[model samples]
Target chain A: MDMSVLIALPVIIPLIIGALSLVALNNHGVQRILGVLGTAAVLVAAIVLLWQTWLNGIKVLEVGSWPAPFGIVLVSDLLGAIMVLLAAITGFATAVYSLKTVRKRFERFGYYPLLHLLLAGVNGAFLTGDIFNLYVWFEVLLVASFALLIQGGERAQMEGAIKYVTLNLLSSALFLTAIGLLYGLVGSLNMADIAVRLQQVEDPKMVTLVAMLFLIAFSIKAAAFPLFFWLPASYHTPQVAVSAVFAGLLTKVGVYALYRVFTLMFTGEVDFTHQILLWMAVFTMLTGVLGAASQYEVRRILSFHIISQIGYMMLGLALFTPLALIGGVFYIMHHIIVKANLFFVAGMMYRLGGSFELKQLGGLYKKHPGLALLFMIPAFSLAGVPPLSGFFAKFILIKAGVEAQAWWAVAIALFVGLFTLFSMIKIWNEAFWKKAPEPAIEVPAPYRNTALYWTTGLLAAMTVAIGIFAQPIYVLAETAAQQLLEPQRYIEAVLGGAK
Target chain B: MTTMMAILIGCLYAAAIYMMLRRSMVKLLIGLILLSNAANLLIFTVAGLERGVPPLIAKGAETVVGGSADPLAQALILTAIVIGFGVLAFAVVLLHRAYEVIRTDDMNEMKGTD
Candidate 1:
């Protein structure tokens, strides 16, 4: 199989499916089947791409064969391949979950097509080697997400959409400004070309200034400290399926961009740039956990946790060593699976309890023990319980921080983990263990949605599998970290020895 | 020319920020438009202004003739403008719909979810 087509499939397949779904918008059944099949195809393509990239170093595809540094390129290394695969998995799960959860009114508004388009944008953002193309893909995703967020046009959704759109538009403007300045300085928009040209830039301060602009832009996207207000403010208002997918994949894209640019383009000012990142990571961690602790709503707490977990990944990047980067990569993989599963559980709890407000719900353990146990898996995993995925993710990061002699970071990571457990426990007590405050008004005897439960259970099972089989995945993450740390192979592969 | 454009861009950014910070959703949309145009202008001015000549080659020439504008910057700004327009259109419709549903344009009043 040609690796170029394989590298391109993750992006191309989704766009094709999205367009097809758009045409068949009136036929809900056909759209559902197409959405499922489309995501399945993307998952297979992403897996094959990852497998091939593992065997052969990096795969580069130059559109129209215009040659490196001039043509738009799609380069898939270990990191990009990993992200694409995770996205495909998340997309597939969300598509299945949406089949049961998304309202007919929303689906009639072309939900399937918009969701697939968002996936295409995500995969394209991951695969693009051209920086400007990354911006375009970001727009593609943002537009689709804006539509999806306000699909039903509810008051809450509209309010959230306003904030989401306004803030994201501002971020996009900043991103464009940064790209323009970078092009002015480097005379190139291809990432590898920029890296090569950036080395010759005489004024490091100017480079640092541009780097800060990029940091702010991507940080807003990633929902880092002081810039994360939009995330919790908007995330909880969307449908569970929407929030689940957004929770799993959206902020991770921002983290991916941050890692890509910092590791590849801004290494010259690591001391200045990464130090700011390090402080941001600490504040992000502290504020996120503290915010989660104060939240009584299940989804809002989960949304805040997303910000907190992002801090751990940023810490890995700020440390900027192979071990820390490995931890970061592993954390991203672990967090996505666990976070999405937790949101799915929250949805089920809503079905069971009739509200997301923790104080209004109870008796799930007495009624549905299976749901309680299933929820425990991801909830405990998110709080870093032993022998689950989150524990390993936190352990590796804390170990890396300790090794880096960043004791303050280690302390913060540990403290945040404890508070995370507190919030998780709060949810457990309120939603499952505590007795129902009143007789369940309209609660069904037994939950019967196989699609939602199966998807949530499968993801929970994956968290366990990743934890028990952590060694191989760790080795893969180590390789990804090495690739990020040493960019010679990446540059050479993309430029074809031009440098 | 570059310095004057830089100052203009700076003013646009300042006005955009000011409008964006207003409580009304309409002001935010206006701010986004200003900011996006400011970004396009920034790209154009920073890439350097070359007038009179177009970025085209003589019929048999291998490369673009000298003293022509950088076609890449123009192409980038064009793409940015189109994308910006699509987003702005979406924002306008979304805000209109939001206003219809929520019955308020003030951002603080629209905090039903939070």
Candidate 2:
């Protein structure tokens, strides 16, 4: 009834269920029930929590009877709550989609538990108030992801999983090192505790070094420029359902952490962090788009765009303004829904045809009109066409960039938008419009059309809804942005003195 | 002592980086182990080395600045070292399978999804 339970439950319940899911290792039916029931519960909890946080201010949950700062705390501020909400939605959609693909047995035994555990890790990272605990949850998910990534043990999966594990392991090490350094310097792991104590640390160089360590760790996780190579190479090899959930949700977690830390704790420590972030944003945007354009594969192009879109998010972060933050948060929400939709479409494409290569497939629009429309709406939205969620995201971002007098960032984002359009169109033209391959292959795949029908319909509807009623969502994003900039509110709530 | 530790750690890190750059999965595994050790040792050094005393204020002991080693950081490092071993175990299992299935430790052949 306190509403904060919803926030803690999204993590706690899934984790509990994840543990329980392992018991049903021999019973796929039990695993399926646990997985779907657990995630659906978490999804419902996230929605209710978001609604509650919107009504009330920020909800804080302290573990064990320990007081805040000393005991670990989970805070569901507007931004974090919204992040959980989007993750829950995308996660649930993928779950439904997975019901069809992940074989009944795998669902019951391994898939469900790993999936729920991953969600728990994601939800926990979003909600935790303690920085050390954030690192712990990150490891929880990364380790679980490692298991999930290699569970099937396909040669392709193993190869990609190796890169994924190595890169993430290095990043996690850097993250912990940074944490150890910060703790050495500030003697506190709570985000609020550090923000307060950081001001007392007089040496600017030490501050910059600590901030750089954090930036590298988060940037690598976010797949920003220079640290982005592992993403596209690895993401495509996983199961479509797994990849769908990951594409929509995981990298955004990195973006969420980056935004939370920089905006709240390191706002004052800006000379090096902000400049490095700014240049990184520019290169990330350009390189991401260029990467997307060079590829002929639908998923590969979309994969690359994930890197580019993160640039826009970082641009918002580096700008350190209310509007820019709003744009960043808004883009995150829009990206989750649209990106999940696109990947689902890619999965659907693979389901129909034997391959995702544009050269191998053709004339999808003729066979599957409904699927074509499904692909069209989110694609158009992802391209930032008018009246869609993507447009609103970019509009606010460009406006915020211009307002911040960040013309170069604004220019790069605009140019990237064009390339995004170009790539989306390329996917459209090559995968759907090009002629059906030799011999007019009949019944290309069994799973294709069913997936295409349900997924495309659901995602396209959501994109349109966001486009139509952007006001409420915009207000939510602005509120979340406002909460982030005001460290006192977050600090006080977590440090136990205030509401 | 600090200089010797720093040099040893530096060499470990360099070896780790070189191994990381190699195509063979086994070499990469070795590199990760060395790098992690170097990192752990660096953390130990930064925590400030001391000969004795253990940093615990046991029952009205003399309160001196250099009296005990920083036990908290030591405990943390111990925990970190254990976790590093767990990672190594997982990596070995993973690499063994990678070689079995892929038939080569060369990462380039593993490129691109099937």
Candidate 3:
């Protein structure tokens, strides 16, 4: 297959599937089958794309046959390929899990179509080589997520959607403003072209100013520190399938943008820019974990943990070393799978206990040992327990921090892990170990759905597999980090010897 | 011209921020519109304003005539405006739905989720 066609398939597959699913709107069964098949297809394509990039280094496709630096391009370096692969995994898992969990009402309301549209937006964001195109893709995902969040249009969903919409709109506005300033400064929208042009610009201060604007704009999107209020307030309001996908993919797109811009474009003032990122990473971790500790609801706790985990991933970028970037990439991969699996497990808990409120739930350990085991895998991994994927990810980051002599960051990272473990244990003790509350509700019939268990088990097994096979993944991350740290290779690959 | 535009953009931004801080959701929408327009104008002004010079090339010319306007900025603004309109429309509809369900125009009333 041609490289250009292969690079575009990750996006084209989802776009075509979403459009086709729209035509099959009235048929829920058809939409469900199409959703699973669509994501599965993208998963396979992502594997091929990753393999091609791995073998050949960076692959760039100039759209419409326009020359590089003038036309939009799709560049797949190792980091982009890894993210695309991770997104496909989460997308496929959520699609299969939705078969059992998503209601017929939602399915008829075009759930599968919206899900695929969101996937297309995500893959486009991961693959696009132009900065402005990234903005367009962000709006795509935002719109799809907005529709997904308010699916049933209940009072609670509307309430949540309002916060989600308003905050996201504000962020988009800022992002657009920053993009305008960047284009004004660099005279280019292609990220690789801008990276080349920016080095010749006379005003480093102006460049830093625009860089800060991008940081604040993306920080809101990424749910970092004070800007993260919208995440917890809204993420738990959606259906489990929707929230699981959002948890796994949406905020990570923001983090990926941050990583892309900071490494590739804003490196001239690293001490200034990354220093700010360091502080944000610290407070984001502390506040997010503390917030999770205070939440009593199952999904709410997980939502806050999502914010905290974002801190760990950001810390890798903030450190801005090869080893640190590797840890960051590894953390992103591990977190996407583990977090989505945890959300799936939460869905199952609600199935059996009929409540997300911890006070109303108990005795799941005695009732369903298998479910308990499923929960333990992701939960322990999330808490950074030894031999789990999260452990290796965290260990490498801490080691990187120590090597970089960021003592305070290392100390805070350790404490955050402890607190994360505390929150996980809290869930275990309250939801599984404690006796059943009075008037225990009967488990729903659909709780026996094999598809749900299979999907969740698939992700959990991935978490364990990643932990057991850390060496190879570590090597991949190291290569990705090397590519990220060196921008000239990326620029050359994208521009094709033009500059 | 650039100085005038810079002032106009600043005013729009100030008004946008002020309106966004209001209690009414309608004001918030207005704020968002102003914010996006201000951004578009900023791009237009910063990309260097020019007059009566089309970005088109004459027949058999290799490149655009000298001092022609930068077409890329206009293209970017067009795209941004389209995206902004879509997002604003969505936000307006979402606000309307929230008002219908929550039965309040004040943004404070929707704080139950928080």
Candidate 4:
């Protein structure tokens, strides 16, 4: 009933499910119920969190009754709430989609348990207030993701998962090392506490180095620019449902953390970090769109676009204004929904034409117009077409860039949007409009005639709904931006520093 | 005693990083072990290297030391060590699988594949 419960519920319930399934790890029927129940509960919880945060302001749920600086705190600002909601929605959608996909697989119990664990990690990451606890949850998800990413023992899966695991393991090391240094220097792990303490110390540059270390770590996780190579290589090889949720979910967490840290922990004297972030944003946008260009494979393009879209989010960070932050927050929400829908549609394409390769795939406009309509809405939104969620988000960002008089960034971002349109069109023309792929081709059929369709449709519908109702979401983002910019509110909310 | 422990830990770090750069998977696993041990030593050093003094702080004592060993960092180090072990085990399994699947232990062969 309390607002704080909104934050804990999404994380705690799935963990409870995981515990239940672990106790019944041998029972297939029990695992099935756990999977559906865990994911649905999280989804409902996330929506509740969003509604509560919207109504009563940000919610801080301290793990123990201890004070904020020492206790692990889970604070759900509008930004955190939005991320939880997206993670929860995609999480449920993926759970539904995976049901049929994993039915014949030998390890359904293990699969559902890992899935629930992943949700817990994701929700915790979104909600946590302490920087050290962030590290803990990051590990929780990384370990779970490592296992989940390699669930199937096939050659391609192994190859892809190896790259994924190796890259992320290195990221974990970097993250842990940074945390050690931060704890050593500041002697506090709480984000709000650190923010306050960091100011009392005169040496801002040392803190800047610390911030840069974290930036590199989170950037790698988000797959930004130079650190983005692992994404395209591995993402396309996974089960479509898995890849869909991944595309929808994981990197957004990275972006979310980056935004949170920069706004909350490194405010006022972050010029150096912002400058570096600006250049990376430009490079990330260019390189990501370039990678998307000429890519024949469906998921490869989607993965590359993930990188580019992260650029826009980074742009919001680098620009460092209320509006830009709003743009960043809104962009991620738009991206999470649309990207997930695209990947789900790609799954559908895999079913129809048997390949995500643009060369092999063709006109689904005739065979599956209903699906075409669903895919087009998200795809068009991603391309920033008018009246879509993508347009409003990008509009705010580019306008903010212009207002900042960062003309070059605005131009580049706009051009990247065009190139994004080009890539989307390529997918459209090749995968949906061109002649259908030969039927004898060997790409395995995706599951249809079941819950997968409804789940995918649900995700696609969210993409549309966000577009149509952009006003309220924009208002929410503005509040999140305001809370982040000041940060005292977040600190006080968590610490009773206000009280 | 504290200074000597610091020196020993520094040596471990140097040796572990050296081993980590090796091309052999077995050596890399060893490197992880050494690196983690070095990290444990650092944790111990930070928590204050006491020769015979206990880790647990007594409510009343004859000594008047400014700071006791930080229980939290020690707890964190314990968690880290277990996580490191889990990761190392997973890596070892993966190495063995790679050997069985591709019939090789050389890291270079695994390169440039994906």
DockQ values, each candidate: 0.89, 0.41, 0.81, 0.30
Instruction: Give the TM-scores of the predictions, in the order they appear.
Output: 0.98, 0.94, 0.99, 0.92
- Candidate 2, residues A1-499, lDDT tens digits: the string is 5555566888988889988988878887777677667778888899888988889888888777477667778889999999998888887787778866786645644787888889989999999988878987887788777777776778878888888878887887778778777877886777888989998898868977888888999889999998998888878877788888888988888989899889777866676688789889889989999998888888888889999999999998888889999999999989999998899888887777657888887888887767788898999898899899999999999999999898899999999999999999888888788888786555543644464467557878889988889998899899999998888888877776433
Residues A356-417, candidate 3: write the lDDT tens digits: 99999999999888889999999999999989999999999999999999999999999999
- The CAPRI quality class of candidate 2 comes to acceptable
In model 2 chain B, where is the ten-residue run with the lowest total lDDT?
B63-72
List CA RMSD, all candidates.
1.3, 2.6, 1.1, 2.9
Please give, for residues B1-114, the per-residue lDDT of candidate 1 as tens digits.
878899999999999999999999899989999999999999998787988887889999999868776889989999999999999999999989988988888888976776
* CAPRI grade of model 1: high
What C-alpha lDDT do the candidate models reach, one value each? 0.92, 0.83, 0.92, 0.80
Top candidate, metric DockQ: 1
Better of 2 and 3 by TM-score: 3
True lDDT of residue A211, candidate 2: 84
What are the per-residue Cα lDDT tens digits for candidate 1 across A25-91? 8899999999899999999999999999999989999887778899899999999999999999999
Q: Candidate 3's residue-wise lDDT over B33-86, tens digit each?
A: 999999899889878899998889899999987887788999999999999999
DockQ of candidate model 3: 0.81
| C-alpha RMSD between model 1 and the true structure | 1.3
Superposed on the true chain A, the predicted chain A of model 1 yields a TM-score of 0.98
Candidate number that wins on DockQ, 2 or 3? 3
Error of 1 at A261 (Å): 0.2
User: What's the lDDT of the predicted structure labeled candidate 4?
Assistant: 0.80
